[model samples]
Target chain A: MASNKEDVKLLGMVESPFVSRVDIALKLKGVEYKYEVENLQNKSEFLLKYNPVYKKVPVLVHNGKPISESLVILEYIDETWKQNPILPSDPYKRALARFWSKFIDDKIINAARKALYTHDEKEREKGVEEIEEALHLFENELKGKFFGGDEIGIVDITAVLIAYWLPIIQEAFGAKLFTSDKFPKLYNWSQDFNNHPIVKETLPPRETLMAYYKGHYERHVASNK
Target chain B: MASNKEDVKLLGMVESPFVSRVDIALKLKGVEYKYEVENLQNKSEFLLKYNPVYKKVPVLVHNGKPISESLVILEYIDETWKQNPILPSDPYKRALARFWSKFIDDKIINAARKALYTHDEKEREKGVEEIEEALHLFENELKGKFFGGDEIGIVDITAVLIAYWLPIIQEAFGAKLFTSDKFPKLYNWSQDFNNHPIVKETLPPRETLMAYYKGHYERHVASNK
Candidate 1:
């Protein structure tokens, strides 16, 4: 049945939260596609040709056309596959979903990276504060079990990074940045997000992710020192 | 007749390219709404309450519910009104439109700012190179009269800043960063974009914008010196 779908191809890396977004969305939608993992240092010509602008992964090449940017790709997936809707049907609801998704991408993600990767104490503290503020804002928006009531929607897909990557990054740095006690609603959401059937199936092994990020972070810290 | 639509309120400023995006979209959609020009230095309580995360302008309050982020608001307006479709109907085309919009916002705008605003010659040169590279990519994407083929779509809305604001900023800073000879396609697009009836009406007066930006840039430069 899935073979009838379009020739969908994803150029992605397993450890990337952005890539995971496309992975989970495709899985949830029951879309069949070929996935090629790209090395950052030695990027494939396919990836380069597909996403010449950014040359970044999670590029969804549908048939001949390539769509870069995970958020954009998610929208493309939802629009193309009508089975399991990743976005809400209503306009207003969808707006709020997009708003929060962009918020997570623009504010929360960058701040989390700084908190985890910055070498200086003051800079790290600032980054931590910004993350806490962003997460606090997100915490208030978690009125229902999931970001969009019961359904795991657009915002959830965007926030998947916080669900999966945050733990590994925090553990790698030995920082309790995003604990259950700090942001209970988000913490709970992350737990629920990771346990989602499609998400669970698609996620990279935790130990592998931890080792990869740990080595990367240590190298980054060492170079700065 | 236009007065009886929805209770729409735009919390924005004249100078902001992002604000201009929402303005142009609303005008094109023929959606009448109240415009409250916020003094960005002293933000309003209403603005703060609505968009606590960014606390920035271009917040569209429709029927009391507020939506922030210019790109997100553009999508909301299109979906709700459905009168003049700002985005393409085809999923692939829509994805491409969105991809370009994201690129313009993330790459073009920032580089333009740095190219014009930075006092250092080397940094300014770097910014200019990045902006030129981005604009060159955009020039190639201009395959039709408009990005939406014939109708001005989401990419056009997102690119409105580059069309109008870029010239103003360049002239204000005494910089000839973007020129007709250099970027014939983008230059021509800007001309068409500015001449569009809805765009012509919505654009801030060139002299007023130049004066405002001139003072602002001078102060910024003086402070850095």
Candidate 2:
């Protein structure tokens, strides 16, 4: 028998919230994995073969089976190694965390993107409605504390997506979607989340992310004038 | 001594996938609870208090702590009681299942609903593209006869939102988003899933669902015409 541990490989792009979520989860869990930076524009064959359906990154290859999607990978990482527990132990509490996480997963990016990126007045108006609606719900979910009831948990992971990605959108749209004064609870939540030690150390530098998204916005979105 | 059993109550709507996922998980795990049908139109004080943010259904009230969101609830159910294990033990495998489940949670309904409900040619076309794109990813993810690989797992529970809801959509749109000829794998997945005794029994009656949706769709979407 070989006395070697199998390597954990992560196929990810730096700019993606989906990919970054996985990275944060891995760090939170304290797992070491090899990283392959995937260019989404010109996807690698291995990526295509591994995740042919989505053609997206943040695929975790363990042993041989390839796992796609960030949250999926997060669960896998949390379970495989028992380090930092990302989810709460109580059933009802865990469920509450997952519910909002899923809500954030569904609403945070896709719903906001079209509106923020659109040149059309109608689409942009719809985007604004969606953004405002999302912020309203987000403010409500914050509950004047963390998403996991006065502690950081899965909803915290998801809330970070908006905190991290919204700046990019704020720049792209030339408007402020998340105002600290307007949604004070949510504002505090973002500040508290970013202040967490594990998160503080691992997060992608803000300036780097800003530079990356600036280029990404101008080139990819054809009608975003 | 007073009753030791917790005050376990589930706030749900009849035709809600979010509600149904938690119900099925609770039932499968042999957990007992009270069911309250929430009138989403007129928000209840309890719902507002329990799920203050979304004020949505499927808020599992256990010992008085309320949990919202279906996926989160499922994980909570799996962790708290530890019966049938809706999520697997291995982290990597569980994450993979969740990733696919989240993808479904995020994309599936929008894709199908847009195709079935929207009247605008461009909107409908965009919906079609989203549905087809989502399907390609699903097809890749669904390698096992079941989404859980052997038994129905959390991904299956999450995917059930599609399995149950699509049939209703299919009824409304006879053009059929998921015929045997089109989404063969999902078609089979849906059949196998719905046929399972636990699932088959758990679902709402088809005729009632169709009628309810007919009115819901017509009244809500003025653009549907």
Give, for candidate 1 chain A, the lowest lDDT window spanning 10 residues: A1-10
Question: How many residue pairs in model 1 have overlapping backbones?
Answer: 0
lDDT of 2 by residue, A57-96 (tens): 8898877789887666666665666566777766555566
For all candidates, state DockQ relative to the true structure: 0.94, 0.60
lDDT (Cα, tens digit) per residue for candidate 1, span A88-204: 999989998998998888899889888888888899999999999988988899988789688788888888888888888789888877889988878989999899888899999
What would the per-residue lDDT of candidate 2 be over residues B1-225, giving only the tens digit for each residue?
114576779999988877888888887887888898889888789999998766798898888888877777777778777768887777666666677777776688778778767778799888988887787668666888888887888888887767887767566656466667778898889889988888888888888788888876666466544
lDDT of all predictions:
0.90, 0.76
List, residue by residue over B23-120, the lDDT tens digit for candidate 1: 99999988889999899889999999998889999999998999999999999999888888999899988999999999998999889878887889
Which stretches of model 1 miss by more than 4 angstroms?
A: A1-5, B1-5
Candidate 2: list runs displaced more than 4 Å.
Answer: A1-4, A110-115, A120-157, A162-165, A168-173, A179-201, A216-225, B1-4, B122-145, B183-189, B216-225
True contacts kept of each: 1.00, 1.00
Candidate 1 C-alpha error for residue B74, in Å: 0.6
Candidate that scores best on lDDT: 1
